[model samples]
Target: MTMPQTITVLALDVDGVLTDGKLYIADNGNVMKTFHAHDGLGISLWQKCGFHIVLISGRNENSVTVRANELGIEHVFQNSKNKIADLQSCIQAIGCTTEQVCFVGDDLGDLSIMNHVGYSIAVQNAATEVKTASDWVTSLPGGEGAVREAIEYLMKANGTWDSSVASMMQEHANQ
Candidate 1:
């Protein structure tokens, strides 16, 4: 599937997309989530190319905030029961349109926004219905570099992958 040529924002669903959809709760009732480092680097690369990233999750968790901060993502909407609404607000705040957004999801909660965005992507382990509704499906499963895979696909589609990689390499060499 061809990516939307004007994509400027990447909206992500956290639980099933950034994570494996498994919630590890301690005896004290704190929830823990594991994020892939590869995905983090992918986000960094995407940002380096001057694109935007947003996280929208139905459930609120502190770890999500921590991770988003670590990645320097400014638009994060947790405890969002209505993802479409949150997405709209995000686009408005960022001065972008839905036609410039690509949403990556892995479950039913992600369906509404998927249909509204310019491009919809599903992780490999996503629900069958989600995959059916997606424009593209990643080869890797969620929490296992699927987000990174999606980022790479988007970068390539937008014709920014080669230059972004070269820039990163140059920066690393300078360091």
Candidate 2:
């Protein structure tokens, strides 16, 4: 297996990646998405380590914006019909090349971006085609600690896992 390059920017899809691919519709006509708290904390940890995080989704959910804001993620593009274009724009805005970016996705919508990035990851519940295209596949299903798994895996590969963990632990201890 080929080893991954150092990744500086982490991009993600929302529905099927951060979610379980199940859209929860409430009786009151409101949409409720269940996000794993572990993933949220992982994103926070990633940011603390100075890696950029971007959320690209084919959805226009308010929850996506809310969640991103909560995580201090500034780059979120929802209702993105063309993920490749959006990803390119994000890369340019961040002044990073495709080789410095890692993308985590689940479905066909995520395929092109995954192919263009330096490292591609698929959640365990991702579609077969998506998984086949990924350089690495997480053991956890999407919206269920999958993002956390991806974060840990990438940090370890980048040789920052221990330091990041220590930083988080120190912060927790101080709290």
Consecutive 10-residue window with the lowest summed lDDT within model 2: 1-10
What tens digits encode model 1's per-residue C-alpha lDDT throughout 60-167?
A: 999999999999999999999789999899899999889889999998878888999889999999999999999999999999999999999988988999998998
lDDT against true structure, model 1? 0.92
Prediction 1 TM-score vs. true: 0.97
Model 2 CA RMSD to the hidden true structure, in angstroms: 1.5
> All models: lDDT?
0.92, 0.89
On residues 1-175, what C-alpha lDDT tens digit does candidate 2 reach at each position? 3355488899999998898878888898778888899999999888988899999988788988889988999999998888888988988988988888889999988888888888899999899999999999999999999999999998888788899889889988999
Instruction: Look at candidate 2 and give me any clashing residue pairs.
Output: none
Compute the lDDT of residue 133 as modeled in candidate 1: 99
lDDT of candidate 1 at residue 129, scale 0 to 100: 94
